[model samples]
Target: MSNANKHMPFPELTANEVSNLWSSFLMNSMQQRLLEYFLASTDDSKIKQIIEKILTQSQENINELKEIFDKENLNAPQGFTEKDVRIDGIKIFSDTFILNFCFDLTHLSISTYPIALSECTRNDIREHFQRNIAFTVKIQDEIVELMLSLGVYLKPPQVAIDSEVELADSFMYLNGFFGGSRPLNAAEIANLSRIIHRAQFSKMIFVTFSKLAKTKDLKQHFGKGRDGIEKVLNSLKEVLDKENIPISASGDYLISNVEASPFSDKLMLFFVNTCLGIFCFTMVNQAMTSSLRTDVVSKLGKISDDMKKFYGSGLLLAIKEKWFEQPPQAVDRKV
Candidate 1:
């Protein structure tokens, strides 16, 4: 490192950095509680080992985040606690579902951590995100290998590309509803496949949560979420179906009929609102931008609008129940 750069004082955390750190702390805390339950319930030794490792890592991350908050004199978020999870509750998801859940989390971390890292100017915060990204990538590889060995991995559709380079020479290539639309390109196919897969997983989660939710309102909210996901899946699947591309559905049978709630309504609602809700929007936005077909873009736009309404309602429910914690904010000088 250069002498001047090394000797320079650390800057105060930017608003972006503070927001990322705050969100990370809450996410990791919730994951820790969820993982603790998973670790207690899993019978597979391999899956148990992975769960243990991740749980430990989450605890460590929480401690580190606490130190950061302490240094800044920021009040730590309440996040989730032992009271939010019932470790003695009956196992609701299969071992495979647990593994896939962890795998899905890696996708969320990989996508967000780099963006957070880029937004940070402080050396300490940058290193924190960098470390998390690396750890999540490593765990993701391990989960994939295990899934492959167990014959549970669902691969995306394979397509053969032409050897010759081609360019879009006419506006007709973008047409979809008019029936002159060009064949789905690699990017469009990928985005469609990813969205389908994610939606399937999310639908299963919604179903499981709905069955276990304590309140009538929460159950209704989850039911609506499940319906919304199915609507999106059908629309996206039709685009792939027209091309005769096969899309594999994840196992909805993985959830057990255990009626007992393992997690508090607050935790489940927060998970849906932040993890699934934010990731869904991100994926749909990416698909919209990458897709050249007008029909595909239009479909995504409609889905995005639907998700905004559904998730917005969830936020209102959280607020009404006094479950939504306020994030750090600028001081009000007028006060």
Candidate 2:
């Protein structure tokens, strides 16, 4: 360490800062290890460059987080390891799928890191999160640019109407139950695009995980989840395809029907749970609201509820297998 960098005056990290950093360290560790496999499997030079750039940034974040943990006298998280990734395993996803995975994860980070940043108070912590957010935005732009150049990019379909539907009367908008069930607006349409794309990705990813799970029960669970998510995807697609809106991240041509266990059951289950949370949040905040079409609102609400139930079951499974990592919690005042 440089003497100048080592000797900077820094305050003790708040509990929030410490907890956030701990969680990020574990997540970045998992991503970095996953990228190792992806980088090895990709044959395309352009895709390799993008993955390598992202992976390099991931590694730097991992190191910086470890240094903070060490300095704070906190035990570094075990996170994932060589065992978490099957080094000599068969290639599970095609290069196209790999690129989309990167894009999806990066897109997700855009929403997640800012939430963490909101709670941060320390200057160093805030600065670190700001930098992380900036880097993520860059990666997102690069992925989109490359996808567009590759001609595989899924753009949201353009909406066309002969005339502006004047909100001339109170009957134009409707609640979830009664009257004024109107067609989707631009915002609602955009949210549907987001929801549909996520559902499609989840189905394909879980289907692969279902086939690759080491245990029969987990396999069945993943398969069932995949099937259930497929219904939701279809419903979402019906909304879009009926209107002829282009769907982005269509998982149709990406993943191959492979026979290999590329990821551990624990890793795959955790991934499912994390995405479930993101989907639920997106649906409620963006899809289910005042003025959305009655049927669309109900559909989004039902799917969000199903995801919550699925998350609960997954939590139980994770607990039983001792795979769920408990985050830091405040001390009980009663204790």
Candidate 3:
């Protein structure tokens, strides 16, 4: 054994680095399958070019993630295979639907990549995720421009302006759990509005997937997620309503029953769980800052907890069915 090698500082991948690698790998894999199918059916040359670019980036990431896992002597789990998607099968989603999905997908990546970048300690790891952030920003901007130009962009409702800036008068603004508290801040309002929109999106996803899912177990899981997310949305909206803040409009109710599976049950379930994971990440970030208000912290915390428990159950099912991919971790040396 090399003595100097053993004494190296931070030689192995940190937990944050491992997670960043694992999540990026899994998401890239899933996106690859979806993008391939979209590209096969896309007739518009512009949309096909965008899809191809994303797929190329994903392939580059997949190769790099494999390298990272190999260096760590970890098994890079095979998430979904060709069985999960039928690339030449019936085109289940419309071109518009495909474009909108890509738009949201890139935006989600843009929002979460910074959290991964922040927790990275190794130079190589930081650079990898930083590239991810940059690439996603580029793609997200293009998607937004396309949506806006096509008049298909869904915008948040306009909030009435205060017109004048006001200074903080007291710390009572932070109180809410036990006593009087000031009105919601700009951050809290924005957070709540975002929550509502995402909840609506999740609800629509569940409704469509539940009907399309061929298995009873998967159907039940989708139904429960639909109910759970709706509950969280209403709870958060109550707080905003109490503050007399107007909530933003919900996402479009444009999804119709496909009556057949375009994607496997495994894929849709995993997709739902992925969204729940993002919601948890976002909720903690927003709620901790909103804690200055009374009752808001506790309410949001409970919702996050409930979401974890719900997602945990579905994750177990995915694992049992061999649909969930195990993420990379440090080597166990007990042998």
Candidate 4:
């Protein structure tokens, strides 16, 4: 390495880099508050340790993002804060639910960070996402190990191996609409299982949030979310059931019936609107692209369309409540 290379001036952050950092800052800040509440309420020592690790990582990411925003002369977003969560509030979720939530968070990070990393032209921004990806992977492994030990891990459906290799010979291979369709492939099975699991989690979240929401309107919003997830789950589950694939049981029992809200309505709504809602679209798109069967793709398309409407409603609610934060925008030259 030449010393001159190190002395080269660094360029300004690109739009992609800023977008990643901004989104990341808001996510970590929200996660930090949620983890704090989880840490306060959790009783299991092992799960507590995991929450601590995640919380520390979230805090560190927020600090680094603050530094970047300051250096770029950009105002940091007013993401979730201490006011968003009441650490002393009664426990709303079982320890198992918290652990599973952590696992899902890591899963999302693993899926998304690489895309963020690839889009960045700046070295510092790339390094930030690189570190995030590495950390989430390690933590995800730990979470899996813990879940397996605790007997809470839900394994995906397994496909039997075939000794002989065969290639598709006819257009009928893609035909899933007519009778005598081909059996589900490994990729199709995996995507279906993943979507099912995500929907299960979302259902339970909506259940809990609905019960704890302060106002009737928010409660109805979350209740509708719960109902929407149920429909998606049924549609996807039917696809798997026709193939005789078994999925894990629902997590509805993991949520408590506590009527008191541990988190502010703003925080809860933002989470559903931004984090879970956006990720649902991403997963559906991935499934739709990977699915070879026409029927499977058609079902996924319908699911995606339903989610768009549901998430659109949530976004509108966020705006109406003033919970939606504006991202970075270009200055108006005319002004």
Index of the highest-TM-score prediction? 1
Rank list by TM-score: 1, 4, 2, 3
Best by lDDT: 1
For model 4, the stretches where C-alpha displacement exceeds 4 angstroms are 1-9, 251-253
C-alpha RMSD of candidate 1: 1.8
TM-score of each: 0.96, 0.89, 0.82, 0.95
Q: What is the lDDT of residue 218 in candidate 2?
A: 85
**Candidate 1 per-residue lDDT over residues 201-278, each given as its tens digit:** 999999989998999999999999999999999999999999998888685247777767889999999989988988
Error (Å) of candidate 1 at residue 13 is 1.8
Query: On residues 83-112, what C-alpha lDDT tens digit does candidate 4 reach at each position?
Result: 989999888788999998898788768777
Cα shift from native, residue 303, model 4 (Å): 0.2
lDDT of 1 at 232: 91
lDDT of 2 by residue, 1-335 (tens): 35665567788878888788987887787787778888887888999999998889888988888888888778788777778877576676788788888887786677778978998876667877898999999988999998888887777767785476575366446543454445667877878887777777777877778877888878888887888788888888887776677776574345555566667788777777765556446655666763257777788877878877777888898899999878766679997
Question: Could you tell me which 10 consecutive residues in candidate 2 have the lowest summed lDDT?
Answer: 171-180
Name the regions of candidate 2 deviating beyond 4 angstroms: 1-9, 161-165, 175-180, 241-259
Each prediction's whole-model lDDT (CA): 0.90, 0.77, 0.76, 0.88
Please give the clash total of every predicted structure, in order.
0, 0, 3, 0
Off by over 4 Å in 1: 1-9
Q: lDDT for model 3, on a 0 to 1 scale?
A: 0.76
218: Cα error in model 4, Å: 1.7
